[model samples]
Target chain A: MAKKNGLDGYCVPFFDDGNKSKFSLASIDPSSKPFSTGSKETDRERLAEIGVLLDAQQERLHAQRVQRVLLVLQGMDTSGKDGTIRAVFHEVDPLGLRIVPFKAPTPIELAHDFLWRVHAQAPAAGELTIFNRSHYEDVLVPYVLGSLDKEERIRRYGHIRDFERMLAESGTTIVKCMLYISKDEQRERLQARIDDPTKHWKFDVSDLDARKLWNKYQVAYEEALAATSTEYAPWYVIPADSKTHRNVMVGELLLRTFESLKLEFPPAKESLKGVIVE
Target chain B: MAKKNGLDGYCVPFFDDGNKSKFSLASIDPSSKPFSTGSKETDRERLAEIGVLLDAQQERLHAQRVQRVLLVLQGMDTSGKDGTIRAVFHEVDPLGLRIVPFKAPTPIELAHDFLWRVHAQAPAAGELTIFNRSHYEDVLVPYVLGSLDKEERIRRYGHIRDFERMLAESGTTIVKCMLYISKDEQRERLQARIDDPTKHWKFDVSDLDARKLWNKYQVAYEEALAATSTEYAPWYVIPADSKTHRNVMVGELLLRTFESLKLEFPPAKESLKGVIVE
Candidate 1:
């Protein structure tokens, strides 16, 4: 592994060391075998077909007037959050869907409790809300950047857990995802930005400086997952080096979650009178 | 024409009409040719095919970062605003879209001008916003229910025209649609609600009372349209008697509007330097 400055090329340490150990993939190892060989391409086609099923299921969820879904996507810069959202939800009804991207807190937001802004964006009953990047930021970025003191960060972890518990009590189901991409892949992507003029606008030299701290961020994510993953809202570590894999995984995961809800359209109150196809 | 309630069936007006002119098929005959024998099947197939095209075109528009789109869907109770939204926007990227149902104004909303609530929901640049019944409610529902006096109703038409113009200036393109279903068809739909327990919850008997004043509403709609339809936001009179026709017309209209916007994705900023996609 390459080393730069005070950072290891492939390892990031942003969270408490105890949390990093939980991400040790017992059965899914990057080095064991090629996860994306020719078979993976066929798997992608199958997933797209299931994506249609996901769309219909989502529609039924809307009509059922039951639970609300909150999809939380957490990833490093250029980890394909935007691309994945576009692909997976492209065929779902716009009526009951909402997407909110959380940027850095403004002065007003910082003045409130950490979860205040996140709560306001929650979906109402019978709707789906996608968080492009969500409350996990309170842990990941702050810890990585040392924006808060060690004591402050620990207090926030407790705050987040309580806030999520409140959401669960209120019938909000959360699906959190951390898109895992290797440093080699990230470097290649950043280099592509420098090499291709059409992509240059997306590249910031400063982003590479942050890339130097990649290992630290990875450690932080692992810790956050270990601490916050609960039965009500589980974190799924998705392989996101390949855009296709992330999209298909997210779609399949959404389908399974919705299936578990067992939603159906509310039954009409009376008998059919004069409704005919013609 | 079957007469009811001492009114000539031919003379009964359409719903959602505010003050302008008492319209009959006499002057414009805007309704398209009535279906010939066996044409319903052909129309149905056309609708499904259009759904595919609409899906693909919406995806293209989203990826290309083109002009914003506003779909204004207005209809009588059960005339299918919700269904139309589901059908037409089924394939759109949820991140790039929003759907807002204009309900009876809340107290804060009522305190402001009618357009205040509407302006808040308009789509941003490079997005699509669908209003399942929109600002037009200021003209439609209020007019049909006789909530506003003649002088007040006429003044609202001017406010609506200017509000739309402002949206256009802010880079939002508007597509306004009125779903025209015959009174007999509406009654049949309502009766079906009573007959089917699954749909009974949707029935509101008072909707029939509103139906009784349909002719007055039609006259109101004709006047509103003649005065407010402008180049920035052209109104399309969709033949909504058939669900197939309604879906295809709305889908094609959206596809054509996006095509006219001449969109292209914002090009990649630069060649990848520190980025990678494996």
Candidate 2:
């Protein structure tokens, strides 16, 4: 049995010709850390190393000033979306990175097409951007809450596939991750916040309402990921119960993805080689 | 003689109740490093310490979920706006910082009121946002290019002061910095970029056009900073000849500003005190 090595082995294959039901989200274990170095201490060290490598690669990308990269992170509450960003990109210069966190839509956002806000924040030339939450919220929330019909959900997913394809073709490398956590883990995390007064600012009663609909959200995610995963923008399931492992895996995945771009510093200019400052 | 301490000494005095010209930009030296720890290596180490402290403060701000902070960076070409962000924010979580780089406006942006695009990107509650270049461009670029008459320029500065005051009154703490670098320093920085072929992507031919109007831009900046510096939104003149000193000064300034906020994690919620997860 050949052990899964890199992130490609975990990517949900591109959905073509309406095969949205083929990928099963439940089969993956939420506790597995295939990318981890087995020891938690070693995993932290590896993540730090990845951070430096990522910082260098990002500098090159910004220097080249051509391609753009967008990372979309979607997960249940308390699944470490914020932690992963802080840890994995600690060494990457914040200059080249744009992190956009989408909260509930405001009235102005609701007035436009679902993708309007997302598109406005898309990475520009020489930029690497991350969507903390994304337009995927539109399909996931409405569908799970029964506000969107099955046909409408499928249509929206199709629209997402097309939108991502266009961005990919226009020089963006799109990577999506769903941080997977078990229901039991969520209970402990939510309870810990409740136990500490200082953490109350982070807790929302409405979050519990969403937790009540966990199964539906899980199902919605499965369908959405299955429908929109493409050769241009593939989705990966990250086991996120262990925070260190989650950071390590995400760091490795992004490092590998960036390396695949083969980004390089543009050739030196010959026009002003001998030019000296006046 | 007593030495000036903290960021207040560099701060452009607040233009309150129609007082504007009392502070002069020319009085500040672009080469001074009042905030440095006397040695370059020590200043760098101090900056790393500030980075961690700022990072912790930012986390507290995020946890509090109330106040917002906006850092507006304005400078001459090659005056280290991007470098300041990268070095000062190295330890801060990218998740908490939002960097908005304002390039030359597009036709759509130009069609709206100058502040329209900017207002849309204001820091939301709990966000620490940086405007790499901001609405100040409206005052400097046009006034220097002679497209905007002094009367119109003054009116625009009034508009900016009001806009920033509004952002401030709405619980946003605004700290603006003008990275001051000498003409000779900028010439060296720009020429070095031109001399390095790999750095061509960062160059714009139009940047040279701006450099040609250096004296005019400086005059414009001095006037605009004088007029717009207000009680609620103050601007600091950061000596930026030494990149390390620039970073250290910025880090200290922001750290001090954030500390003044007295941000704390929200108090524990009594409602969920004994509630256990099902």
| Model 2 stretches with alpha carbons more than 4 Å out | A1-5, A17-19, B1-5, B17-19
CAPRI band for model 2: medium
Q: Estimate the TM-score of every prediction.
A: 0.79, 0.94
lDDT of 2 at A72: 97
lDDT by residue for model 1 (A110-171), tens: 89987989988888888888999998887788788878776886687778767877887888
What shift in Å separates residue A5 of candidate 2 from its native position after superposition?
Answer: 8.7
Angstrom error at residue A160, model 1: 1.9
Q: After superposition, how far is residue B229 of candidate 1 from its true place, in Å?
A: 1.6
lDDT of 1 by residue, B153-200 (tens): 778877887888888887887877777777677777776767776555
Residue pairs in clash, model 2: A197-B268, A268-B197, A269-B197
lDDT of 2 by residue, A1-278 (tens): 11122676567766863456678887789988888878999988898899999999999988888999999999999998988898898899888998988988999999998999999999987788989999999999998888999999878888898899999999999989999999999999999989887788889998899999999999999988888888788899899999999999888889988999999888776666776655
Count clashing residue pairs per candidate. 64, 3
CA error at residue A151 for candidate 1, angstroms: 2.0
Top candidate when judged by TM-score against the true structure:
2
